[model samples]
Target: MFKNEELEINLGPQHPSTHGVLRVKLRLDGETIVKCTPIVGYLHRGVEKICENKTFFQGQVWTDRMDYVAAVSNNLGWAESVEKLFGIHVPRRAHYVRTMMTELNRISSHLLWLGTHALDIGAMTVFLYAFREREQILDCFESFCGARLTTTAFRIGGLREDIPPGFIKQVQAFQDRFLDCIDEYETLLTENRIWKRRTIGIAPINADECIAFGVTGPVLRAAGVKYDVRKAFPYAAYAEMNFEIPTRTEADTYARYLVRLEEFRQSHHIIQQCIDGLPEGNVMAKIPKVLKSEVNEIYHPIEAPKGELGYYLVGEKGGQNPYRFHVRGPSFVNLQALPQMTEGRLLADVIAAIGTLDVVLGEVDR
Candidate 1:
């Protein structure tokens, strides 16, 4: 009688390809992943618990840290959630600015994903090329806010201030030139034999499975779902902006790559519209000197760069701080599908699967 034995191996918590302290325990049958278990929490900072201790205004800072790469989007989501709870109406001009910033942050976040994902798949040139464009976006961000990475640029009612004199021109210049940058990246990877072979058919999950797993953002869209929070539930001038939600039926790693690439174009379009039709008015709205909410509890979700980033706020009437605060981070939810995607695939394909998900550990563990 012959017997087969499965081999168990740990893939991270320190491995570079696992991307930031993510440990995956893999049961391998000779390089074929028979079973996979993702272990997170290495980056946990108790962001939700910390928010309960801080005033609503101060809690905005921690949101930036959750998805540190896409800080502007985090700021917008946090501010809008508080605004909804307080019934504070942001000025029209402020909404436009917020939309523009959020879109720019989206592009920046995607650029980082592209670079790092390509690097993981052995396309070194694409990494440098992607970062070249990302740097310009970060420069624009630093010009608007003092910080490039963790820019807590939004306030509970509106923005911290108006756009600087040359900020619009700077953004416009980048917007005009950015499409060519995307083309350059595609030239390097979209049709490359190795790139296609590595990504095209790896880790496919159907739209039904994605929904069942509570997935959102590009992963869900790549699986042929047309759900986008911005279009379905608009906020922060997204209703006024015209853009298409890119979707693919392939439901594979390559499809996700294509969807995100098209998203770059759509984000550019939204920003251009904001610039062309930007209304002139107060950037800040009138609110009480001290922040307090009559609403006992409320939940608000925004189309963050990663996915639907929702916040649940609980507090009593006239409370200075939230009694309880919880954040539904997209990365945290999205990470759940990792094991499903990686199981039964070749061990080498694990890196490709993880890269395609575009997860940030900070958001996952927070």
Candidate 2:
């Protein structure tokens, strides 16, 4: 008689596929994952604690580092939170510009995800093709804010400055050509035999389970939940924007891929609307040099590219800094579902599972 034995292994704190300093302790039985535990905090910078020491205005820069891929979205969330806490209303032009920037950020973030996730699943060609379009978006970012990645693009009351001359034309150029690029990516993977074989039924979960686990973003939406922070709790001109919340009932890796892909198109639509209906007004509201808050506490949540990125601020009567500052990073919450998805699956499927979650370890660990 032959005996089956269980083996324990560590996936990474150094493995590239783990998507940053994330280590997974896996109990395996003949290549099947029997149990999984995710180990994090290798990249922790005490971001929340650090915010408490910095003034409210200064803390805006730190939000960029949390989800470094979509820094504009982080800027929007934090700026809006500060504005809310101070009871300052942003001007109409600032609202439209912020919305446009955030939607562009969403497309960029999703492009990165699609490229890397496809690469993880063994589609190298898609990776190269995706970055080509991504570069155009980055070019727009650089021209607008002079910074590409960690752009501190938003001010508390509004934007730092108005869009430069020809900025609208550049965005329009990208908009006109972007859909064909999405179609190219889809042709590569959407119906490819290998992609479907690898992802179609992998890591499937129901809507209830996702909600129970506090998962958000494409992961939750793929489970057939129509919950989108932009739609449900509109902010930064989202209430005025017309877009669809893409969802799928399959709740598998393939479904997540589709949901994110659809999001790219929707983001493009919102950006077009912003460009067409952009209001003419002051970009920056008149705000005091020294910002103080009297609100006891406030929590503002926004639909970031990854998920619901929220800032919880505890304000002091006269202090320039928040007494208590915390962030609800979607990557961190969505990552908790990894073990549930990976357990009982083959070791190779772990890569696909993590890729589909679209988690950034910078956000996860912070």
Candidate 3:
């Protein structure tokens, strides 16, 4: 008699497919995973611990680095939290601009995912194509705040800078050309046989399991629950803007792909609305030279690329320094389901599953 023996295998802390310093210890029977454990913390930069030492205003910059893929949205979350703690309201124009940049960041994130995800699935052209588009968005970030990644352009009271005079035209140009680019991406992989074979029905889970696991973003939406923070609980003028929540019921790798594809379109619409209806006002609310003195703060919010971001701040009375600060990141919570989600799947499917989760290690390990 012949029997299959169990084997324990290591996926990576250095593997490119694991998406940034994630190491998986897998117990397997033949090629099938029996039990899986994800080991992280390789990238823990002590962001929270570092925040405690910095002033509230200074701490907000650290949030930008927590998720390099969508730093503007990360910045928005921290700024909103600090504003909430201080009880200060941003101007209408600042609200509109924040919405604009955040939506752009969302599209950029999805593009990065699409490219890298496609590359993992064996579509070579997509990696270059996706990064090509990403470079343009990063250029916009540089033009606005001088940093392509980890942009700390949002302030506690409002935006760090206003849109330059010709910036609107540049943004509009990107929008105009975006449809063709999207169509090209879809053409390459959306209905491709290999892509579908690698993704469909792989490591399936339902909405119940996803909710129980506390999964959010495309993972939850792919399970058929349309619980987007933007739609369910609107912030950053999202309530005023027009957009739709993209959902699917497959709860498989393919469903997650479709959900993200639909999301890209919805985000595009939101950006156009923000640009069209942008209000006029001071880019930033005037603050005292001493950040530790003068005003406290107010409410602020912007829809991040991942999901709803909740921020709360406690600041010193009559000082600009924040006494307390907290940020709720969607990626960290979303990643909690990895072991549960990856168990019972093949090793090849493990990579497929993680790609569908779309986790950035910086956010996951933050």
Candidate 4:
């Protein structure tokens, strides 16, 4: 249906709005976009190759660097993959700790997304306020893992250790204060006529188009596809917890925005369950002191802050390291639909559409 004559223009590699090093070549007809082809690889860090060179647990640090915004999820994913490969079962407390950390990271990620996405569409102040909340989340991560951004807290079988005394109390306190900040954020935009006008019905992508284009996570769910790896494929103890996988049929910027907002609430709910259901078990499972990579194959998939993050590992029996390792970065897949989603939408809506998609450079380019 996008039949406008092509007029190409470069859209980002350095632009702050893209939230990454993606260079999208936009084909526009006047002020309306006809097509968009996203060019990538600027931030390529060879994380997959790096994973192959390291031992199972050693490779986890690389995961932390991939999706920097949600290091906990990335760490959890790689660890889970190695665990699957070696048949290393995790403990109950370890599962709870992983869930708590990952959910906190999820909130941190969405906070950054909301801020940056809003800023891309002209709401500058939202960025600052969102970070204000993000700092608290980061504090929680730092308290537990010691590093706020690049945390290698999760190990092959489980966590490096147990959560420190008072950590749960601090997370609970942060959660208590966090709801008010969410309210503040919603009050700023949810009902604002300008926000709604700029977002609603702009850049609509239908459910089939989303699936066809390989969209996942909130973007796919925003199109009313309730396919979360967490619920459908229960890795960790997510099946034990209760939360909704927010979906919206509008499939536009506004719909995606609402979907993310609802997801934040759901993540909060999951965190509460994790805290309430904290069980007693060893944080780190007993395994071989060091892995002698016999991993012919390893597949670890987790509900990442962005979407589904799957780590693929391959190794020969008795090998010192993996033969190959690859990350199915959700940002890479989710972004494939950008061209289809932006078709016939205004030039301004392209940024809003991308913002709603919630991509990170480390994940997208890695």
Candidate 5:
């Protein structure tokens, strides 16, 4: 007599590759995955609830803790949303500086994703090369803001101060040599036989499914959706920046890799445009010393590293703290597609799927 049985296993709430306290309950028929269910909240910190209780000025700090790797981007969203709430007009120079720093933050976030995602798939050389560039970006962040990782770099209406003296020259020096660095990443992993074998045609999700799942960013772009918040909904200085949204129809792990590499080029282009076209004016905007709001609600979205990071706020009359607050974190939304990407695929491909999504659990569980 012969018999068949499906094995059910938990991938992790603490494994290195799950990328942050994420556990997937997987049912496997031999080595093929029958189903995958991602379990989150092991790292939940009630960030939204905390923000509702704090003054608007103090709430931005908590945004830094969510998606800590892309904290500058988080800062941008929080500050901009608050500005929107109070009808604040940010200075043109401040917008340019914000744009430049946010683009730099995007590059830094992608470099980390490249390094760790590659490392997860056994491409060690690419990991080292990617981190080298990431370190330089972090150094730039440290110079601009006192802290490197959790940088509360922006205020409500504008930046806290003007860009530090010599900042332009420092960024220029990095910009001059950075294209070559991107080429180096390509040489190591773009055509490598092992890298291709691990990534190509693996962990694919179609464009229709991506949209249905509310997935955005490179993952959705790889499916040929061509939707980007920066392009679709202009924010900060993106209205003036000239760049293209990179897209591919393959919708596999390999396609996402290519899309992000192209994004690296575009982000570099935006930074250059900022450095060359930076206007001279006040970096801070004029607003009331104490921010108070009438009954109003707003939802502001920006293109963060992973995807569309949106902040939703409800203001009360003369309220110093938000009446209600919520965050539509990309990681939380994108994680919904995991089961669709992994079910009926080989067990090992689940790792590729999680990595391709490029989620940060801090934002996921926040």
Candidate 6:
């Protein structure tokens, strides 16, 4: 009689496909995954603890490093949370500009995901094509904030200044061609037989599983949950902007790809709205240089490119720094769904699962 044995192995603490220093311990029965456990904390920087020691005005910089790919989104979350804690009202123009920059960041973050996810699935041309548009968005980031990756773009109450000269024109130039760029990405992969074969029924988790696991972002949306913080909780200028929450019922790798691609179009639409309907007003609000807080706690949530990125803060009376701080990073929470997606599937599908989750380990380990 032949005996079937299970073999266990580590997928990565160093493998490029794991995305960022993530290690998945997998038990395999032949080529199929029997069990999967993701081990994190490799890149821990004590971000929450460190932010508690920094004053509100000084702590926004650390947010830039948490989700380095979507630093502007992180900045928005941090700024809004602190603003909530202090009850500061940001200017209308600042809200509009912040909305535009954040949507651009959404496109940039998604582009990085599309390129790297495609590369993980063996599509090399799509990687290059995705990064081509991503570079232009990064250029926009640099032109606005003077940094591309760790852009601490927003202040506590508002912006430090208005959009730089010709910024509208720069964004419009990208807007004019971005829809076609999304179509270009679709042309290469949407109908490709290999892409459909690799992604179409692989690594599926239905809406119930996603909700039970607290999954959000494209992963949850792919499962047909239309719960976007932008639409549900509405922050920044998102409440005023027009956009759609893209969802798919498949809850598989290919479905997630289609949803994110549609999101690209929605984000492009939001940016155009901001450019056209941007309000004329002061960018910064009248807040004291030194802000002292009352004993208060606030939790603020935003729809980051990944999912619901939330910041929870506690303030002490007359304190310069937060008494306690916690981050509900989408990557960390969404990563919980990995085993649900990967177990009972082929080991090769694990790569597609991780890629589709779109986790940035910086936030996971922060």
lDDT of 4 by residue, 214-288 (tens): 778888888899999998989888878888888999888888888888888888888989998899878888998
- Candidate 5 Cα outliers beyond 4 Å, as residue runs: none
Instruction: Point out where model 2 deviates above 4 Å.
Output: 1-3
lDDT of 6 by residue, 1-366 (tens): 878999999999999999999999999999999999999999999999999999999999999999999999999999999999999999999999999999999999999999999999999999999899999999999999899999999998899778899889999999999999998999999999999999999999999999998999999999999999999998999989888999999989999999999999999999999999999989998899898989999999999999999999999999999999999999999998999889898999999999999999999999
Error of 3 at 156 (Å): 1.5
- The global Cα lDDT (0 to 1) of model 3 is 0.80
The pairs that clash in candidate 5 are none
Cα distance off (Å), candidate 3, residue 10? 1.1
The model with the greater TM-score, 3 or 6, is 6
Instruction: Rank all candidate structures by their lDDT, best first, as comma-separated numbers.
Output: 6, 5, 2, 1, 4, 3
Clashing pairs in 4: none
Runs of candidate 4 exceeding 4 Å displacement? 1-6
Write one digit per residue (lDDT tens) for candidate 5, span 28-47.
99999998999999999999
**C-alpha lDDT values of all predictions:** 0.91, 0.93, 0.80, 0.85, 0.94, 0.94
C-alpha lDDT (0 to 100) for residue 41 of candidate 3: 88
Pairs with steric clashes in candidate 3: 83-298, 86-297, 87-297, 87-298, 88-297, 88-298, 291-320, 292-319, 292-320, 293-320
Worst 10 residues of 2 by lDDT: 291-300
| Candidate 2 structure lDDT | 0.93
For each candidate in turn, the TM-score is 0.98, 0.99, 0.93, 0.96, 0.99, 0.99
Across 256-289, the per-residue lDDT of candidate 2 in tens digits comes to 9999999999999999999999999889989999
lDDT score at residue 340, model 5, on the 0-100 scale = 94
Candidate 2, residue 124: the lDDT equals: 94
RMSD list, candidates in order: 1.3, 1.0, 2.5, 2.7, 0.9, 1.0
Superposed model 6: Cα runs more than 4 Å off: 1-3
Off by over 4 Å in 3: 1-3, 289-303, 312-324
